[model samples]
Target: METALEKRYIDFDATGFSNEELLTIYKKLVLPRLIEEKMLILLRQGKITKWFSGWGQEGISVGCAYAMNEEEFILPMHRNLGVFTTRNVPLNRLFSQFQGKENGFTKGRDRSFHFGTIEHKLVGMISHLGPQLGIADGIALAAKVKKEQKTTLVFTGDGGASEGDFHEAVNVASVWDLPVIFAIENNQWGLSTPSREQFNCKQFIDKGIGYGIEGIQVNGNNVLDVIRTVRSIREKMLQDSKPVLLELMTFRMRGHEEASGTKYYPEGLQDEWKKQDPVDNYTLFLKEKGILTDALEKEIHDSIKHDIQKNFDLAQNEPLIPAAIETELNDIYAPFTQHVIAPKGDQKEMRFIDAIQDGLKQSMEKYPDLIIMGQDVAEYGGVFKVTEGFVDLFGKDRVRNTPICESAIVGVGLGLSIAGMKAVVEMQFADFVTCGFNQIVNNLAKLHWRWGENADVVVRMPTGANTAAGPFHSQSNEAWFFHTPGLKIVYPSTPEDAKGLLAAAIEDPNPVLFFEHKYLYRSLKAEVSTDYYTTEIGKARTVRQGTDLTIITYGLGVQWAEEYLDQHSEISAEVIDLRTLLPLDTEAVYAAVKKTGKVLVLHEDCMTGGIGGEIAALIAENCFEHLDAPVKRIASLDTPVPFAVPLEQQFLPKVRIDEAVKGILKY
Candidate 1:
């Protein structure tokens, strides 16, 4: 049963390693294998809810964790249980995590290997497997910037290798020469589809050639081969700071999970792979070399099994997580105590676009660790020229450009923020964000909620219509992010708020979607402060005071409301500007609603599923008794933002706001 290697490790005598070194490697490989076996029993008996089995592939995780320096990070997917156990995560806590204990890594907010331990430099996986690759790239990028000699060992499966995040992450890593080992466990099947069907490439390592990086395929069942290869590779990465694509050729000896058996596989376990089982064969190899004995093997198994069973039993008695999770939402975002406005500073005339660029410049100056990336924001000054001269001011490193991979770039921003650096990702147009929808919603928005990690990242979206960018380019998609909690949304209409809000969004220690209307970029101008400052987020600004009725709006609707009221001075319409869409200033909204006893919620986004509906609902639920008229909502017509100028104007809410105000007054 001694596993014969294609080639002996080092010399025939195991030249470079001592007896203890070999035994330690064997212990690390055997630990998770036994722990997972215990977990499978629990799953069958209903002690734990679920399990993503790491039944077959322990060598890859062991080799990577054993070779990695303690300071280096390991971002592992679901099957890499060895990565956690070998990285020295406490057994008690991990067992508690598996059993849904309240004191687990995510405090029972999440399950399985879906949580990360920052203290141990272990970032866990999301079920959406691919985004972790981009997160690893972000971590490597931060290490490179900080001049730390660290490389990240991140994993994906045969199925995950074909994902767009895989393409984007590896491309960005190669382009930047980041120190990352993108290890793909080619486990023969993605649930049931074989590797041959999942990708047409000859070998998973073959992908590195396209990205212009070194590629290597290791015999994943051979623990000695893996440990030696990974240790050597880490040395080379430290020297060059270059990425390598490692293909850990292995198989999922069990089904994808316990629920699905090997029935879907069609051609079940081939004899060759069964004989090459990583843990059993590695144990035989150690025994042949006198590194381990029957007594030692029994002792290791008994001791590890004892720890696993003991922790599982202890965790079962632990109290269930408190049902009132709504209490923790406020603490997810880091507190911000910064200048709300410029302090007695000189003022100058500036357009809305100029003020945004100036605000970004000042933000960079204030937070030296802050970075901004987008399609052309670095050299091209972005599509709207908002970053016109940012390159000359901030170096290419601080103001970087990214490939047109929306999802990956947003995940990269999250990764950057996770590594203690603030990041801002600019979507070329707001409509294009749909391409990155999963990352923004799942990865960026939920990072803090699930992992208890603050995300100090800002996504700048150039939205709104009337310039004839058509449906693909023009969209008022603030509602898309507003509905998702744990994200802050800000939409500004004036030059002053644009500068102040951008500063605040960047300063806040959470993911913020900042919507800047393309129509208002150059159309508005005013005296702006030259000093660095930020406007308070989540608070509405009173644009004007009146008693007849209240006009509640954001973005382009604010401007149209002002213009309509300016023309007819006798209307006496009070307008409230909702600068921050999420964490809404309900106090200001309710105050305005009660004073006028009539309210009109307006925005340029489509009326259906728009934020105006949420505002109207809020007014109805809380201020029903104080209202004299039913709350009315005015928004652009429910259709694509059209191409023609006249149609676009009609599609916008300018005329509708004028009519809604008049209609609500008569109500």
Candidate 2:
């Protein structure tokens, strides 16, 4: 709760620095300010799209980066240009990032400060702002789990403090006792809103009291204060294995971005803050300390400006990202364990839930870097007890029970993935995925595609209806993440496929969403594989073959299709089970359509925007010449799962598949 400036570097010797280190600090503080100025010129010249100014806040960015070890990471925001420079990320590549050039870190995939390269140990921010805090928690977790001597620092603005992710992430970090420094640059304004309207607390650092972590406030305009404070708390954070929230108090001397002028600024406020400008203050201190002279200062300025102009000019003329399907879509997922592991033998009959648990268990045994986290997955054994007895087998360190913060946990998984850990996060129910959608869609889904950074994480989504669990608990929501490009979706029907595909999902390098139907958890049973095995993610299984018709389905739909055929044995049908949704097995689908000359698409999801629609389109577009009849889709009515048994039966797509099958035959 300490809000006052505990230490100030007034005199030259007060900073406790030799001349050489002081000069380095001065250079670091000056570089970002100059970069901002140069980027503004580029913006005005129509060379770049936009730029966020770090005009007065260089001290916080520079000092924190300078204080940390080279291997320790900083999840930075747009204004933390000093972080990239201090980390020695090549200047040419950094400028190319701004120019949307192929030579950039992200291969021109992202033009904003939204790219992270593991080589430099620097991950940038997403526009959402708050989720990165949890990612920092994961990075710290990796260092702790590996027993590496490292600490992680993350940056956020005053405005970012209000986001629910901030609360959730900080709490997760504190509860886990992670070695993280949550550095908040209190720059007095977020866009046009001042700090007065953001919060009523004495200062933002006091917000840390609820989490029971130490809070420190420093004068951000004084580079020495930022460096010293971060240095002072880092050991404490590491030794105690806890987080520290450091609030850097400063002013935004300019508008948020270059184009948005400070027209909303209070009169005379910018002028007053100008007096405490970090770059100017640091330069004056260095000059007075005899660490810098007029000639030396000019030499430093000339050197940096020359470096900036050379890099910027080269980046300006660099080749733009190619305009082609192959180049644009390449590297959506990093290389993974694609070779399937052959099963040893068939085990005794087991329920669908047991198969899922078996897959997760086998995955843990196979990969030592794997960690399983969810709401109750540890000692409590998850909501459905899917991970029951896992903590004792795997130990508590690996089987972690997470707080009910869906968004932050997902972000944490992403961090773990970046730090080279295979993370499995089980959502209590798939419907709660809405709470963490941004992290899945934006952070986990995009990182590998963005920079070839593997997101080796699996989100086990317990989905589907028919248990009368009502709207919240009984939603078949795999379709929600299906439309996104970077995520892999798997929906298995039989217990054997569930075990194999779940194993595949965990082994895959990209972020995979494994949707397990809640209705099938205990209702379905089969003889599953006894040994660890992985089914190819994008392949389809032809469960039943017939010449008369083709019925393509997955998950609960597979059971329904078979049940319909059982009731009416007259209809000869070939049922193809699409175990994976993302990389749909187009070849198998086309082959089935070609053979039957009629296709019926069935799924448990609602009619609109369902996987059925995509299957129908693929048939219509690819097999138009071979088909004798138009493709038909059967699905549940577009509504939330109902509470009443009668209503739930109507909402489920049981009888409709039979009707759709008969209708397709007549065509």
Top-scoring candidate (lDDT): 2
**Candidate 2 residue runs with Cα over 4 Å from true position:** 1-13
Residue-wise lDDT of candidate 2 within 1-667, one digit each (tens)?
Answer: 1111223233333357778888888888778877888988888989889888888888888899999998998899978888888888888888999888887888877866788888889998888889899899999998999999899999999999899999999999889999999999999788999888988999877878999988899888788888888888987776788898899998887778878889999789887777777777667666666777878888888899999999888888887677778765667777665898866775779899999999989999999889999998988899899999998899887999988999999988989988989899999999999999999999888888887788888999999898899999999988888888888999999998899999989888899999999889999999877899988899999999898899999999899888888888898899999999988899999999999999888888899999889889888889999999888888899998898999999998886776777777887
Summing lDDT over every window of 10 consecutive residues in candidate 1, give the lowest-scoring window: 4-13
In model 2, the worst 10-residue window by lDDT is: 1-10
- Winner by TM-score: 2
- My TM-score estimates for the predictions, one after another, are 0.96, 0.97
In candidate 2, which residue pairs get closer than 3 Å at backbone N, Cα or C atoms, i.e. clash?
Answer: 376-382
lDDT of 1 by residue, 1-667 (tens): 2333442232223568788988888889989988887888888889888888877688888888888998898999888899999988888788888877776887777888998988889888888889999889888988888889888889999899889899999999998888999998888898878877788878878778899999999988777788788888889998998999999988887888778777876564654576667877777667778888788788888888888778777777788877776657755556556557653489989988898988998999999889898999988899899887899998888888898888878877887887899998999998899988888888777777787887788999999987888889888888888878788899998999999999999988888999999888988989988888789998899999999999999888888888989999988877999999888999999999999999988888999999989889989999999999999998889999999899998998887766777788897
